[model samples]
Target chain A: MYKLIWHMAWNALGRRRGRSLLVTLMIGASLWGLLFMEGIYDGMTEQMIDNTVKSDSGNLSLFAQGYRLDPSLDRLLPDSLLNQQILRTNPLIKSRSIRFSHTGLLATAHAARQVQIQGVPLEEEIVHAGLSDKLAQGRLHFGSDGNGAILGHGLAGKLRVSIGQKIILSAQDRQQNINSLVLKVNGIIRSGNQPIDDKILYMDIEQCREFLGVSQGFSQLSLILHNPDNTALLQEQLLRELDDSAIEILRWDQLYPALLQGRQVMKTFNLICNLLVFCVAGLGVWGVMTVSVLERLREFGIMIAVGTSFQQIRAQVLLESTLLGLGGFILGAGSGVATLLWFVEHGLNLEVFQEGLQAFGMDTIIYAIIRPDYFTTALIAILLACTASVILPLRRLKQARPVTILNSQ
Target chain B: MDAFIEIAHLHKTFETSREVSTPALIDVSLTIPHGDFAVISGPSGSGKTTLLNLLGALDSPSKGTISLGQTMISKLKEAELSPIRRDRIGFVFQTHNLIPVLSARQNICYVMRLQGRSQQEQESRVAELAGKLDIEQLLDKHPDQLSGGQQQRVAVARAVASRPQLLLADEPTASLDSTNAERLLDLLEQLNHDEGVTVLISSHDSLVINRARHSIVLRDGRVVADHYERNDIP
Candidate 1:
């Protein structure tokens, strides 16, 4: 019986090909738009987060509890076997390094600016800091003695220095005395970040330690994760292992509240956009289905009069709507994937509108990402819309008097 | 056996609007034995179609008990009426009302399919009915493509394909010309006498009234006459 009804439903759709085609096209276009929108938006946000993590925060960070509020020499964490052991034992931690950042002044022949000097071990930073990848000039190496510095793009602009230029960096020593050094620029990094590019500098961690006259202390332990999703678990485990009252652990969300809030806003905005698209598609399907049902009023009456249960008729209608939605869903998903692949391969260049995108902290070139779940979500949304559309038509079916329907011309 | 289909004290009324009750059927009782070819003749507003609707389980009586086979259907819900109709009763309407989407063959076989008959049973029965109704050549043609007479032939084939205990047709010949009307009435008679399918058809045409083996004349929602007729071949 159910099979017969299903067959009938399919035939009904085929018989009304024009209406069904119109409905399918409406839903398919909406779904395709939604898929593209979701992919692009998610890709944009994902790229931003990934660049932020890669260019700066290593997914997780350890700091002396009060150190971020006050970046002072005295708050430096001691470099010990405990730190080394924790890094060594946890397989989830991809890489760990010590960083000693201090505020200083950089002066050159043409310019002068206050700079935040970042100290990294050359070999470790090469693999982990992605420092090597960001090089816009010269080499990433600071040499063994740390007498060289890599300038951020904006800092280089401000100091009027590039690779091979000489600059003077001066800061207070650990003992509260002013000390200075003359260094040549080793590399220039373009990390696409405003603050980091404008006022930050990178040098060898050992050299920064020597310049500060601190042999056993470092500012914070930075960690890169194999899978960033494991950051919270690792942070919890690391916190328990360390048991230090002076130290705290942080995840990317906690470390970057503003970015997290931005991602949330984008998500909600995408949801609203998708809902609007769904509403349009839903109204199309509903409008078509209502007309289709009305046009077949007499046929439905004959069916009911010939002993077709209302339940069976309702199922048949639901099946028809579902198949309609499935058609659109499949078409939408197929084209969505194709478009995403094209975007992923060639990238969508918005360089013409670069300033506008940059204002929102987005890269000029947008690469689309395909997440399978988005297709699932689109399918579910369409199915729900299609099913919900039939409630009124089904009610009409129930109230249909066989006599009246049959008697009508 | 208790009448193949029995109705007792059946009543139906419609509320046209507030404070007005118009009776359609009143104190109607009927017994139709198996293989009976019953024709109901009445003028418009005389309730022939209403009685057919009640007997087919398409509508319920306001106050009555209707037994088809063993199930009492008049008091049963629509859900219960469905299978009794699908398995034991078939309907033909004033307009052939063949499912427009289906071809003549599929439309004829639809009731059997609803009863979950096997594919082979459906094919054999559809083929048998097509041949009997002389619609074999029109099997693949949809209702709109078929002539009115062809559509009614398919409708009758559908009605008898399930071999139900009773077939209720309301104005089965209303849409037909005289020649086609005779063709359909002849088929209905063959279904009654040759196939032994009990048939109750509602019509007002004197030609139909003259052809019925048993004639039921209704007036103002009551049965005024019931008897066998010496069917005149005119």
Candidate 2:
């Protein structure tokens, strides 16, 4: 009986091939589009989070309790014994980099512009941070000279200086006195972050400390954790260890809430788009099933009159809709996943619109990534949409009088 | 052979217009015993089809009782009526109501399939009925692919393929030509005489009534004439 009912369903589909294909395409194509959008959004979120955490704020940052309020040299979190103990004893800390970050002016033979000076211990940064990977040109080094320096690529372009050139930087020392330093352009970097690439500069932490005339002071201690998610727990642990001193521990989300909120907004937008697509797809299924039942009413009446049970008839109709839904899902998901695979290999480049995207803190190149659960969830959603679509036609079946239908045309 | 169908004071009303009820079968009673070759003849809306619907348990009567063998079916729910329709009664209709999607053999095997007959049993019965009806070569063709007569023959074969205790046919030859109609009537008569399958056929065709040993004629929703003509069958 089951085989025969399936046979009927199959034959019915074959009889109306165009309508079946149209409905299947409606569901499948929309589902594919939804999956693709989800992949791109996920990729964008991952890229943003990685760039923010690895390039700027290392999963967590340590500051003096009043430093964020004042941001003066006196407010800096110096190398305290208690803070060093907390940083060393924590198992979640994978690596650490110390830096003295400040804004200064870069002067060349023909140009002078505002620039950011990040005095970092280069060796520790290579071990702990993704800063080394953002190098678009030259090596990630301060050159052979001990007085070597690195310039953000955009700043180098603006200065019209290249490797082996000399530049002058001047900033206020810790004592509110102006100090000047001359360094060679050892290397240049572009971290795909516009603000960072355009104006940032890098030098050794020891040099920065000596230049600032501070014997044992560091501006910030950036902690890279083995598990970034452990940032909150480690912060709480550090607070516990310190007994509420003048130290502030910050997680990546807390340091950069804009990224988090942007991701949330995108997620909500994707969800709304998915709902709209599914609604249209579901309506297509309902329309096709309605027409199918209407076209076969006489056949159904005959079957019911000749002892095909109503339940059995319902099964055939349900199977027909299921088959249609399944066809669409497979078509959509199959093509969608294919596109996702391609995206995982060669990322989609938005270089033509790079300037527009850069203004919004987005990358020029976007890669797509998807979890397995996305496909599973799509299958369940499509199946439900199709199953619900059959309800209207099945109700028609339930209310039909075989005698009356048979006696009429 | 002791199986019988008894209908006592059957009534069916149709709502033709607003706040008006028209009677199709009015206080009708009928008894069809085992192995009876009976024909129900009538004019349009004369309740011949209504009586057949009641006897087959397809519709509930307005105010009467109907029993097939010992099962009281007039008041039974729709759910209870299907098994009787599936297991005991088979139907053949005027339009040669073979499922257009299914081939001739599949249509014949449909009711037997519903009865949960084994594949081998279904195949053997289809072969036997197709051979007996001289439609063995038309088994693979769909209903539309066959002639009016061939579709009717396949329909009759389906009605008997399950070896049902009762076969209810409504205007089985109404759409056929003289020759095909004659051939179909001859087949029904043969099934009744040979298989002892009680047959109740409703028709406007004289050929149907002339071929049955007994007949009940209805008019204006009443049984105006009911008789047995022994000479008609032999």
Candidate 3:
């Protein structure tokens, strides 16, 4: 029975070869557009998370309670022996570092600017944050006394400071006293993200502590876990091990809730775009099927008159539509993936939107991030849309009377 | 012999529009004994085709009983009627009505295939019928490639390929010229006489009516005349 249906479908399609090809191309183009949009959006979100976690924030970070909302010097997590003990017990803790991040004023030969200053131990920062490899200028070095600093390229330009130039940093201490220190710029780094490049300055922990007049304490401890998804599990473990009164555990995702939300909104926007593309494709399918059915009305009548049941005729129509849809989806999905790869390898230059990106703290270059799951999702969506578009034609074929159809022809 | 087909008080009304009801057949009854060659003759719009459809079990009467073989056809569902049509009945239409996609041989074998006959049996039967119908030369050709007379012969071969108990043809010779019509009627008459196949044909062509042993005339959906000839008139 299945073989008969297939043969009939093939014969039906063969009867109108030109029209069938045109319909297949229309469906394939629409599917490719929708799949491409969804793939790029997924890729971008993945890239954002990877870049963020790899550069500064690890999978999880620990700070004093309320430190994220208010990064005052007074909210520093008091360094203690018990904290070191808890850090040792977690096997999934890949690497841990202490980072003191705060706003400070920097002055160079040409100008002065406000900057986000992160102070970490030179060796640990180099190992955990890949900071040494990110240097685009002079080599990152920790002098024998550990007092040098690294400025981001954008920040260095704003302050007109080059490597080997002395810059003065000033900030208030936990005791409410103003403290200042002079340090040589040892290197320049670029992290792609505009705001981070424009406002971040990295220095050794001792230098940061001396500048802030906090000789004995650091503000936060940042831990990088093996898996980001286990943040809640590790957080639970940390809570059980540590005294709640001493420090707080925070996941990087929670710290940047707005970023995650923005990413989610972008995904939803892409989904809506995909759906719109599919709707247009579905209209094309509907048009093709309606025309095909109308053209084959006489053939359908003859088959029914010759002993084909209504159900059999309906199945044949559906089978033909499904075959067309499957072929289109395969072609479209392949095209979409190829297009996404080309875009990913050569990113889009959004230099014209530099000002807009700057306003939103984004980079000027946009890269499409492709993933296997995105392609799968797009294929599923295309198949579903194609199947849905055939409903009307199938129903029409089912209800049509052979006598009327034969007479009509 | 038992009546191979019986119809009692058959009525068919077609609703052409929302408010217009046209009667195609009314109070029409018929009985065809086994091995009888019967012809139904009437003018245009005289319900000949409608009656043929009803007799073939392709349709149902509005209010009547139709019994074919031992089964009441009017009471059977569409799925059940298909098997009876496949094994017990065959039909031919005015246009040769061969499935254009299949070859002449395939058209003949299709009914046998539907009857779930063995491949060997179907092949042998198709070969024998195609040979008997003199369509052996055109067996591989599609219906579109054949002449009207040749196509009608293939149609006849296909109708009898399954050795059905009854064969109903609707104006099988109406589309052909006089010479082709005569050839087709001759083939039908030979099948009726030599093979003992019960044949019922609907036609207004006098050439066909003259050749049939029994004739039924219909007017306004009722039988106006039912007569049997004492000798072959054609």
Q: Which ten residues in a row have the lowest lDDT in candidate 2 chain B?
A: B225-234
Candidate 2 positional error at A136, Å = 2.4
- Pairs in steric clash, model 1: none
lDDT (tens digit, per residue) of candidate 1 on A276-364: 99889888888878877878988888888777888988999889999899988888888888998898887788899965675565667
Using lDDT as the measure, name the better of candidate 1 and candidate 3: 1
| lDDT tens per residue, model 1, B1-234 | 236878888888877799998999888888877788889998899999888888887777788888887778877877777787788887887678899999999998888888888999999998877776778899999999988777877888888889887888888887778887887888788878776788899998877887887788899999888877754321
lDDT of 2 at B52: 85
Candidate 3: regions farther than 4 A off: A78-86, A132-138, A142-147, A160-165, A341-355, A358-376, B76-80, B100-125, B134-147, B177-183, B186-196, B230-234
* Predicted structure with the largest DockQ when compared to the true one: 1
RMSD of each: 3.1, 2.8, 3.3
lDDT of 2 by residue, B165-184 (tens): 88999898877788878877
Which regions of candidate 2 deviate over 4 angstroms?
Answer: A78-94, A108-113, A153-166, A242-244, B1-3, B19-21, B177-183, B193-195, B231-234
DockQ measured for candidate 1: 0.67
For B1-234, candidate 3 gives per-residue lDDT tens digits of: 458888889999888899999999989888877788899999989999988888877677788889987899888876676677777777886667777777888788877765667879978988877766667899999888998888888888888888877889999886678876786777777777777778899998889888878899999899998777745422
The parts of candidate 1 lying over 4 Å away from their true place are: A81-83, A108-110, A143-147, A157-166, A175-182, A210-216, A356-361, B19-21, B63-65, B177-179, B230-234
> How is the predicted docking of candidate 3 categorized under the CAPRI scheme?
acceptable
TM-score of 2: 0.92
- Give fnat for candidate 3: 0.06
After the best TM-score superposition of candidate 2, give how far the Cα of residue A326 lies from its true spot, in angstroms. 1.4
Question: What is the C-alpha lDDT profile of model 3 across A1-409, one tens digit per residue?
Answer: 6666787778777777887787778778877877667656655566566555655666777777777778888778766732566687778888888888889889976689998988887678777877665677987885667768888778998888898889988877767777787878888886655666788888887777777778666766777888777878988988887766667777777766766887889878987887787788778777888878777777776666656666777787877777777777777877877887787887667789876764554545557876676667666766677677778876776666555566676
